[model samples]
Target: MGLIFLGIGIAGTILPVLPGGPFYLVAAFCFTKSSERLDNWFKGTKVYDKYVEGFRQKRGMTRKEKIRINLIADFFIVLSLFIVDILFVQIIMVVLGLYKHYYFIKKIKTIKPGEIE
Candidate 1:
């Protein structure tokens, strides 16, 4: 399971249609539950540096990255509204979408990946 999410997250880093950061986070979380070796291996990988390191360190992401992630999350939420038929589920998804943007904008501090300033 963890390996699967880990694979998707790695793929997501290259594929625009998939959101890499979230998938990596999920994979990391899942890995922690199973093998410390797996988690450490991932942390040592370039994918971790590219997608999860800053956020994991509480340093946040670049403004542009945040926007891209939020928009991708919103797109999936809206897509779910069509895929799911229950009004309550749809409403929950909408709320989650709005909360996604709100959390990124309000709760996080943004920083570029390699800016010295």
Candidate 2:
């Protein structure tokens, strides 16, 4: 999964249509959970430093990043809600979606690119 996300992230960096940041973040997370060596290697890369370092440090994301990540997540959640007719699952999805927005809005401090270095 980490390698898959890393591949997508690399491709996203070259492709105009795909956004790289979210995939980089997922790759970093997967690498961290899977192996210490992989996590260290990934964290040493420019991609991880550029995309995930600030978020890891609790410095938050740019407004564009927050919106893009939220929209991508919301799309999948809504798709699942439509596919699964279970009321409980749908309710959970709604709550989770709300919480995601709230967390990003309140917990993450939006900062300027200049603030990063």
Per-residue lDDT for 70-112 in model 1, tens only?
Answer: 7666666677688889998787777766766776788778887
The TM-scores, one per candidate, come to 0.63, 0.60
How far in Å is the alpha carbon of 112 misplaced in model 2? 2.2
Per-candidate total of colliding backbone pairs = 0, 0
The parts of candidate 1 lying over 4 Å away from their true place are: 1-36, 56-58, 112-114
Q: Which clashing pairs does model 2 show?
A: none
Report the C-alpha displacement of residue 96, candidate 2, in angstroms: 0.4
Tens-place lDDT per residue, model 2, 1-117, is 999999998885654335566788899889999999999999999878777896777557778888877787777778878888999978887887787788778877887766744
Candidate 2 stretches greater than 4 Å from native: 1-39, 44-51, 56-58
TM-score, candidate 1, is: 0.63
Q: Which predicted model would earn the best TM-score? A: 1
